[model samples]
Target: MAKVNGKYETIFIVNPNLGEEAIAAIVEKFKTLIEKNGTVESVDDWGKRRMAYEINDLREGYYTLIQFESAPTFPAELDRIYKITDGVMRSIIISRD
Candidate 1:
């Protein structure tokens, strides 16, 4: 039988250069998006931190982690949004189930 839902954990790095308000907006955007599509288990904002390697000349980024349970197909749509969003430096979504 097909799984109706799956637990997922996603971590995304936002470009810190956008400043606090922009950063918060980005975080809120994703939080709402997730909440609309799933049951959010937790949202962890790790705040600004230096990266291990430079990405597009950036050395630091604001990080956020989200844990949720949703239909198995939702992560793909979430990932696509992350890739297209301007301030998102990087993102990864993993199935916890």
Candidate 2:
């Protein structure tokens, strides 16, 4: 099937142990990754917060939300990158349109 552009939001949690510079680099990396294939509408940095439960032995995480518009095919690549990146603890991408 042919792909169509759509609105999507991605929320990712990064390991809180990373330093400030490392955290910023991760955010910037994903921002540019999306901007390369889509138009980014907004980026909301939730900063570090206590998680309801521990993940990988960590009780806190840095949360970030990105809302963007991209082709249907693009999120798969985004997900792939997220998985391979070392400090990302979890992530989810949802279609908003």
Candidate 3:
């Protein structure tokens, strides 16, 4: 039988150069988006941290991690949004189930 829902964890790096307000807005945007489509288990804000390597010539990024349970199709849609959103330097979503 097919699974109706699955557990997922996603982490994304935001460009810290955007400043505090913009960064907060971006984080809030994704939280609301996930809540609309799924049940959020937890959210962890790692704050600004140095990356293992430079990206776009920047060395630090704001890190956020979210764990949730949602329909199997939701992660792909979420990934699409991340790819298009500004200030999202990197992102990855993994199935936990």
Q: Best-fitting candidate, measured by lDDT?
A: 3
Task: Quote the RMSD, in angstroms, for model 1.
Answer: 1.3
Worst 10 residues of 1 by lDDT: 1-10
Model 3 clash number? 0
Worst 10 residues of 3 by lDDT: 1-10
Worst 10 residues of 2 by lDDT: 1-10
Query: Which residue segments of model 3 deviate by more than 4 Å?
Result: 1-3
| TM-score for all models, in order of appearance | 0.96, 0.95, 0.96
Candidates 1 and 3: which is better by lDDT? 3
Arrange candidates, best TM-score first: 3, 1, 2
In candidate 2, the residue pairs with backbone N, CA or C atoms under 3 Å apart (3 or more residues apart, or in different chains) clash, namely none
Indicate whether candidate 2 or candidate 3 has the larger TM-score.
3
lDDT string, candidate 3, 1-97, tens digits: 8768899999999999999999999999999999999999999999999999999999999999999999999999999999999999999999998
Model 2 over residues 1-97: C-alpha lDDT tens digits? 6677999999999998899999999999999999999999999999999999999999999999999999999999999999999999999999998
What are the per-residue Cα lDDT tens digits for candidate 1 across 28-60?
999999999999999999999999999999999
The candidates, ranked best first by lDDT, are 3, 2, 1
Return the TM-score for candidate 2, rounded to 2 decimals.
0.95
